[model samples]
Target: MHSTVILIEFGAIILGLGLLGRFAGRLGLSPIPLYLLAGLAFGEGGLLPLGASEEFVAIGAEIGVILLLLMLGLEYTAADLVGNLKAQYPAGLVDMALNALPGAAMALLLGWGPVAAVVLAGVTWISSSGVIAKVLADLGRLGNRETPVILSILVMEDLAMAVYLPILTALLAGTGWVAGGLTLAVALSVAGLVLFAAVRYGRVISRFVSSDDPEKLLLVVLGLTLLVAGIAQQLQVSAAVGAFLVGIALSGEVAEGAHTLLSPLRDLFAAVFFVFFGLHTDPASIPPVLLPALALAVLTAGTKVATGYWAARRARVSARGRWRAGGALVARGEFSIVIAGLAVTAGIEPALGPLATAYVLILVIAGPLTARWTEPLARRLAERRRARTPGDPAHGRPAAEEATEPAPVPD
Candidate 1:
């Protein structure tokens, strides 16, 4: 009877998600918000809470996260990561300052303490790669000139997580300085070793993993990723980071094959992951935090746009491209939840999870809209401003043109 109930509940959840996804598709919107809403509806204090399928959803959620990072890692080679890191280090620093400071400041103002502040800072710092990737692909902006700039910032953030997660873990654990330092050392060493191996032996590793048979290839890649992710989590490193490293270690045909084969699985689990997040948060808890979350979301959205515009301008991208870049980075998703989840599990602040949930829901929904509209809106605004400006006789151009003339800035 218990098994039957679990099956029925799980099946209903999946069917509901499929319907929501289809509805979102027909309306030309992202299905993320719908999935999250569905989770809330079926979570605690909701219309129909689930008891039997919660454990299954939790496991699927973990795989969703792992696959998300792995697919992201496959998008770039180690050399590309190194190059972007070197060229875009300053932008990464700027991104951190602009986006992270606000979240930390808000936490302090709310008296959540330095620990919760740090965790909250992480919640706001990183953008949603999964959502952004989908938006870019949907809009066909992958080949846009500003895309590399946007991608560089994401790569830097992902690499930063290798250092940040371990440190956050140690701090949350209240470890002594020596113990924390040891944890940091181990994480850095593991990351460095993985990167070095990827740089030197990527092709060889791919060759070994490559299979002509699709079934065999899928099994090998999935099994290896899970094994590495598990080991990394056991070592106090992030499972996402481990999966990312495995992705980094495979290149060429193998990476392409893995991406193709695993995409459907990634999509399925990723949806479950978002729903899992909602399942944990009580719908009743969100209203209290809604005002603050809305304020923070609005503030951070502008900051993210500014961050993207500045980075893109520094790269000498055009005005429209810069706006596009900024808009693309507006969404916050899986990683924020992962960071806040750790703190929540540690019993940090009771309200932090609710706040993060509301914050992410606002941004993730707005993210796609911003990406689709920022460029067109900026262009229209620019055109109006140009029409209002008097032509300069000396330069034979309007003031707006003078202001936006692209300068050649070296990457």
Candidate 2:
């Protein structure tokens, strides 16, 4: 009877998710927010709290996060990551400075102390790669010229996480300086070794993983990724990073086949992951933090736009593409929660989780809308400004060459 009850609960959850997904599709919106809402509805303080399947959902959510990172890694090779890191390290720095500072400043103003400030700084620094990737794919902008600039920034951020997560873990643990340093050293060494292997032996690894049987191929790749992710977590490095590195190490037919087999699994687990985030956030806790969360969200959104514009302009992408790039980078998701979750577990600040939850909720919904509309809105504003200015008296052309260029061709 207990087993049957668990199955029934799990089955109902899946069915509900499927319906919600279809509804979102019909409305031409991403289903993430809706999925999160469903989780909230079934969580504590909701109309019908979950019981039998809650533990199982938690496990699924962890897999969801790992799979999300792995699939993201499969999209690029070690060579791509290396080139992006070398070329776009400056943007990453700029991103950290502009976006991270606001969160830290807010925490200090609220008298949350230095630890909360550091935690919040990380919360604000990283954008949601998963959400942004989905938006790009939905809008067919993956081939856009500016996408490389956007992608490079994301790669730089992911690489930054390898260094950042270890340090954060040490700080949260309140380890001594020597212990922290040692932890950071181990994380760096592991990351460096993985990158080297991916770059030097990617082809060989892919060839070995490739097989004629799709079933065998899927199991091998899944098993290997899970094993590596578990080991990475055990080392306090980050399972997501380990999964991503595994993806980066494979190329050619193996990568393609793995991606094909795992895409569905990634989607399923990713949805579960988002839902799990919402499940932990009590609705009552969000009200007090909502005001601050809104303030921070508005402030960081603008800074993110500026970062994107500067990066795209440096890349020589068009004005529209620059806006698109900025808009694309506005959302914060899994990583932000992961950071806050650490603090919550440590009992650093009672309000931090609620703030982070509210912040992510607002942006995840607005992100896709911004990605879809920021360019058009920017263009309209630019045209209004140009119209207000007198055209060149001596030449038939507009005062700015950018004024007359065609819309950026979609990729």
Candidate 3:
């Protein structure tokens, strides 16, 4: 595309995203659904004929995730990473494994080849934390006990899947690398990444990056994001992985504030990244993969709700908390599609893209709706439990007392 055309396209993208953001806010819905609706409207399906390519839009979506995950990583510490493993490992190991199983079986039933089924199944195992986290924060559940457990699982699963995605795609594409002790290489690389993050970038960014200056801080963040991503590419892992580590390392208070310095930048990139996703799909030629995409959406989202509920129950949370967990796990946003795109770039197959997109879209819509109403849903179940247990503490307590209670003292 010519520079003029590129500039014009970018300008239109900005305008469309701005409008959709406003519209979504008014409707009390996530802007993602609206952005996608706009994409369909302006894409081949509509009269505008913007000629957006799923491949290109999707690629931008992946970059957006890398940036977002980089932010997420900024929130972690070494013990937290280990704590994530302990808190999240079993649930994630089980949830993702079971989730993929059904998806693979369904794909095989649909007569898809094993490779396609595997790729599709892997894609389905993904859940959208972006949408989930947003809704949790919106509903004031971010610091809740149940929320942290769900988030821990999400973090572990995302980290694992990020690495697994490229490997699986390479495997399916017959790319000769995994065979040569690639797992060992990955493990070592991750260790090296953690070390580098701590020793090289962790302690000194405040001083070395001249973070006292606003412009300098932004440059520091942007530079580190790209730098780590580039290094990940050379290591055959993922730049997003490195970026996430950056986030984790930096999650500490670099300065005294309610929100970190990265807040505006995070919001800006996140909007661009997701809006870019919205701009990617062409409704006129809704790819044939949309059907299978919807199928995987049902498969994955349904499985997540069920599994998350079960996990929350095992953790001995209230029925309402289980429902919250279910709602939280319903969406598959940036992380899901990023993994899918990685598969394609690794030469897995073309069909996977549409399938992942369809599922991701479904998850985005379903996740927030579930989260938005989860409190009411939780209350209903709590009421039911109180009814059955006659004299349940929930009912026995005065409303004012309950309001002052600190979440039932968390057992």
Candidate 4:
């Protein structure tokens, strides 16, 4: 009875957040930003100050990211990866590097300690795939040229933990250098092989699991998801990465509607995670640090903007179109919090968790404000492009799609 009550108490907090997100979505606001705001409001930082336990909230947040990655794996195909790369192969790499490198350098310079610097670098490199994908879908731009670039970058971001997190975890566990390095290499290799094998033979293997028994298939998927996750834990890998691979493996292969099986569980707990992160952060500490947090936010936000433009310019995109793409890429959500949270877990530094949390809070607020502003900028650019090219309503079509006239012989 006591256990049930405790579960209900924690459950209600997250349930309420989802309800709030739905209401916000109805008002033309994005659910993720509102989700973060609700977290802030019901959090220690916000008015309510829930005093929620960090461990509890972390579970929810972890599941939220887990579900997101799984769903992405299901939707993504190697062809999709190839297409995404073709559109903007180097964009994500550039953005993450530019963002992470400078951040690490600054952290080192600040006398903040190596752990904090490395954590900042990792978090800065991540872009919110959940946020970006949702926003792009909402605006009906998911299939456009802009989208391929976005997707390519997002996929790279998802794979980052495979490379960085395992080593971090091993070090924190006090494993010897040789063992930690070996574990890291093994984790990457395992994940790569599994994913590569799945992609290469997905179409063939998926056929066997194609059945009408949604419940049964879902159970099978759960077994696989947890098993892979356990393997990752044994390897000192991030569970989120394991869950992602599981989801990727299960994607499109299980029964048609089987994806629905995990939705309720994902939702119920993801709320708890948001509230936990909010609770872990002490609002009183925020005042003295507000200025630096704000300054850092501005620097990162500006860098993302520049990153989008640089990618666009490399692709020979127009000045206005570049700005629109840049604008669209500005929103960052789960990646920052997840990486920061992992840093604390990895024991890379002390008081580092709180610092990372503070920085994420800043990004949460800043991301939406930038995204909101970009909406109008994109519209204006489209209008100008259309108006300037009166003869071609669709602007420019590729040579393959156009009807070519036969060339005249010598005059």
Q: TM per model?
A: 0.94, 0.95, 0.81, 0.81
Q: Which TM-score value belongs to model 3?
A: 0.81
How does candidate 1 score on lDDT?
Answer: 0.89
C-alpha RMSD for every candidate: 3.4, 2.2, 4.6, 7.0
339 in model 3: Cα distance from truth in Å?
A: 2.4
| Poorest lDDT segment (10 consecutive residues) of candidate 4 | 402-411
**How many residue pairs clash (N, CA or C atoms closer than 3 angstroms) in each of the candidate models, in the order given?**
0, 0, 12, 2
Candidate 1 lDDT over 61-89, as tens digits, reads 99999999999999999889889999999
TM-score of 1: 0.94
Q: lDDT winner between 1 and 2, please give it.
A: 1
> Tens digits of per-residue lDDT for model 4 on 337-365?
77666666565654555555566666765
In model 4, state the lDDT of residue 201. 74
Q: Which regions of candidate 3 fall more than 4 Å away from where they truly are?
A: 41-46, 51-62, 177-188, 195-201, 204-210, 255-261, 275-292, 343-350, 374-411
lDDT of each: 0.89, 0.86, 0.65, 0.65
